[model samples]
Target: MLFTDLARSLPATIPFVGPEALERRMGVKFRARLGANESVFGPSPMVLEAMAEAARESWAYGDPEQYELKRAIADHHGIGMENIAIGEGIDGLLGHLVHLAAVPGDRVVTSYGAYPTFNYHVAGHGARLDFVPYRADDHEDPEALAARARDVRPKLLYFANPDNPTGSVHDAATIGRLIDAVPEETILVLDEAYSDLAPDGSLPPISLMRPNLLRFRTFSKAYGMAGVRVAYVVGEPAAIAQFDKVRNHFGVSRMAQAGALAALADQDHLRATIIRIAHAREELAAIARRANMTPLPSATNFVAIDCGGNGDYARTLLAAVLKRGVFIRMPGVEPLDRMIRVSVGTPDDLALFEDALMGAIAEVGRPTAT
Candidate 1:
């Protein structure tokens, strides 16, 4: 088959093999599906109704300009419509952003193990990837990443607040410092997928904008719309316009647009979901502690439980938990891998996980020597 040299060189892989794929392979259904950071709390009831309405009108193509969705998003955030650009999801938008800001062999900097999907896109485009280690507290170190970006002067800098896998967060002041630290020539890719659930002061106002900064958000997390495949980016008009040059005009599905618009409108439902997530997060943390594991403080909808060992130990814990019909995931690299990353779930789901975790610990014991 004909292919670019980059395609020929890249490894074929899915960044995460989702639970459905696991179910097919294992020939068993998970009782509590808590992996992949998806919200078990579900979308607002209004969103479901909107999606149903959109489904009946599926004969027409979605608006290429994403006009209404953009208007709604802008209004929700109290930002100018010109500052927003909607796409399939943060995953798809990141792909477009990488394409817009980087060229083959150009540099892209991120934490050593932040979101792998961003790295996947960078690699697919043949970009040289740079890494900065997380702070000892397991948080993405904005200062360290900025220093590396200054030294390397990469084309793109990737930072996720309320980070994935770790679920740790930095306050707005620290994030502002990192944004300021980024070189004028380097585009800062601020990923805020979990921003909806973040504490009040953890996020800067939506009015914040910079020519070199692009903040990515999604309906996938708190809105419980991961299956809907819709998200958007915020940046100055000039930078936002670049997405139009390379985006799939019909990529954001009609159903997704309708659902996200409705989700945005239902602020009360969103608040309720947020409260549910917060409560579930606490329950998950307490479960971790009762299992003799250390649960890191989380501002995101998931918790990272330290297994008090290394990657192998956590991996063992995760596998045992999975075999017991509670699907959870752990980070890929250490020392974060010493912790398992579990998405918040309902009472039933959390109970299943609690039993699974205790049983797994009983069977596996603890992390042994390398």
Candidate 2:
């Protein structure tokens, strides 16, 4: 076999078991798909129209330079086009970053139970991962991560603003402090996948730049184009250039570029979808409260509801919910595993989840003393 020693040594791990795979395995389709944090409301009408129009030209590959889409993104952020590097998605960009920076046995830093795909990429590139635990309040601890990065002097340090799983966010001031605190030699991989859903003061200014900082954004979340796989990383030109040496120049398809460009142009539709997601998030919190579980404050398009029990109890509840035909998920690692996460959806979709929750609770019952 020609596999690298790294490849042979690593486990066959997938970051997520998508809902479709779950349905096939369980032999039942989900009544409401809320597990993946996808925007059930979907992309704007303009995006659909653009993608459909671009489909006719799909025989030719998308522009390797991604000129028009990159220009639009640059104008949106008031940044130079030279600072942007587009990829299939944030996941693909992260993989490229890891490949560019880490060699076998190099270290990377991230929060425990943060985005697993980043960790998967690090492992695939044969880098060692050093994890800092989340704060007791469930937010990713930037200070702790900074300290760890300083200690390890890692090749990359990963932090997701408006973080996944917990859906907690830090204000711009605090995040700025973390950014400044990162070791000079370490690249701060700022994953802002949910930034569009965050409050006004939650994100630092787009003009903020450092040689060691790279911020990633995607059209998947607030723009409602997850399936399209279009996202980009913004950084100083030198650091951003590293991706070009390694990235698949045409990995982003023509339809994806057209759809994302259209999505960016339709700010009105984006605002409306954000408003809708906010309402649904509130409803989700209300449902959690009704079930006597605690919903964490979220700045993103999902809510994490504490099941008021341990990991086992949460797992049982999640299994019950899935069996009731609603797809949902929980964090895989400890402590954070006490909650089940659900994405924002329409009234009809959430109503299904609400019903599933009640039935699942009825079936599983609450955890009791040993």
Candidate 3:
């Protein structure tokens, strides 16, 4: 085979199977697309206009420097333009970081059952991964991760604030301690993908920069441009420069840049979207309560509702929900997997999910005592 040894050794996999694939497999169109945590509310009007205008200029490749968008982002965060590196999304930037930092056999550390995509990138590079388990409260345990990183001195340590799967978050002080604790040799890959939706005080200051820490934020969430695929990493200028060595210069499209620029300019639209997501999140929690499942406290746009059972019960309920034309997701590993994750959606979308949840419970029934 022409493939490299590293490529050959890695399994063919994606971070998550998208809802389209599920719709095809199940032979039913999802009446409500609540899975995958996409912003069902869509992007701002100005973003649509900007992207539309840029579409006519699509024949030209996006500027490799991405100067305007980077400048806008830097100004927005009160950081210098040198501190930014743009990419397809946080996922793509992460891949570049892994390639830039970790060679074969280098160690990387992340929480078990955190963002699987980061783990996928680590595996692709043939780096060894050491996992620290999530806390009993379902939050990623920063102190535990810090201890492990100190011991292993891994090339990269991945931590997501307002984390995926469980939608849990720690205060800025706790995150600040974790940031300080990371070993000098290790690059702290701080993923703040859901930062726009995060409650006040859940994020550190944008001006905070460390040579070994890179913070990733995206237009995909509150900006409602997931399909546009634009995200950037913020760090000290020297640390951010390394991404240029491995990133595809033109990977972020012209339309994406235009859309994200407009999205950033329109703070009103972003704030309104956040409010809508919060309301939807509350409705989702209420739906969970109506069905007797416990909704985990969330600072992001989704809720992880405890099914009050084991992984098996959650999986069964998820499958039933899918069968009923409502799409949702769950964590794949133990303990965390006992909850179903439903993204914030429209009133009609939540209505579909509520109906589906009740029916799924009726079909699968609840878990009995051991």
Candidate 4:
């Protein structure tokens, strides 16, 4: 009973603890479920109907090629179908890409305290991680990242546009500059999980001209298909074709494909959901302000509120909220970890959050005067 060296070194714990697991541990249901950044609004009605229709065909395996969904995605993004690669989710796709690009001992560059899932995948493949501190202004410093890439000449560089935990976003101009600075041999993995909620001009336009850059998008956020787990990557045809060498052929389920296709077709539903999410973000920010906390401006479906203290104080607040049955999360590192992240939800959900948060604050005692 021996495990591979790589598997043996990896921690036995799951990276994310879902809300259900937490509920089971605490022996109570959460009054406000805002953690995990899921779309509480749920999927579009059209998507639901499409999934129901596809349910009858669930006995059949999905098209291994993923032709229809890929074409829909390509047309929506104004890209060629050959340039797209579909997968279970961005998480699954990331693992495959890291395996393809990085060999053991190769360097993989990412911002300190960025997406842990990417780091997890890189480590699983025995790649060395090179972390650059996040910018003081809260955005990813493209110049700093570029400098590290140049110095280390890492095989892969990963970043999320509207960064998780902090919800800070880098503009298109900044991203373009980083692209120009990266070495030709290095693969730039841009995780745009929150792209749909981003403000106009926030993301770089689709440009397959760059051979080294790969951008990932998901139906999990604004489209409200997280359970469906539909995500895709856009890059040069050569880069996309490489996925065929390693990806799970029938990984994308028929139900998921149908739901995603219907989701994509209903532009109105997507637009309405984005608008609602934007409003929820603002409402959450206002709630933070009234509570004397600072809510960082976000381009995502969640808001990170500066808890007006250190990581310990944030944890205390988190625990208090949990006691009140409101589920939320905070960063795992210093500086950024001083804030707790709350996902946008429906009005009733927000009401529960507000009540639970106020109750939690009361239970934790008032902030001390400096």
Output the TM-score of candidate 3.
0.99
**Worst ten-residue run, lDDT, model 2?**
361-370
Better of 1 and 3 by lDDT: 3
Tens digits of lDDT, candidate 1, 1-370: 7999899999999998998898889876899989978898889899999999999999999889989999999988899889999998899999999988888989999998789999999998999999888889999989889999999999999999889979999999999999999999999999999999999899988799999999999999999999999999999999999999999999888999999999999999889999999999999999988987799999999999998988888888898999899888888886778889889999999999999998999999977756
Each model's lDDT comes to 0.92, 0.95, 0.93, 0.89
Look at candidate 4 and give me any clashing residue pairs.
Answer: none
Kindly provide the TM-score of model 1 when superposed on the true structure, using C-alpha atoms: 0.98
Higher-TM-score candidate of 1 and 2: 2
Candidate 4, position 195, lDDT: 94
Candidate 4 lDDT over 1-370, as tens digits, reads 4988888888866667888999999898997889988888888899999999999999999999999999999899888998999999999999999999998899999988888889999999999999998888777778999999999999999888888978888788888888889999999998999999887777889863589999999999889999898899999999999999999999999999999999999999989998899999999998888888999999999999988888888898998888788899988887788899999988888878888788888888765643
Total clashing pairs for each candidate: 0, 0, 0, 0
Model 3 regions lying over 4 Å from their true place: none
**Residue-wise lDDT of candidate 2 within 198-262, one digit each (tens)?**
99999999899999999999999999999999999999999999999999998999999999999
Q: Judged by lDDT, which candidate is best?
A: 2
Candidates' TM-scores? 0.98, 0.99, 0.99, 0.97
Where model 2 places Cα greater than 4 Å from the true spot, the runs are: none
How many backbone clashes can be found in candidate 3?
0
Better of 1 and 4 by lDDT: 1
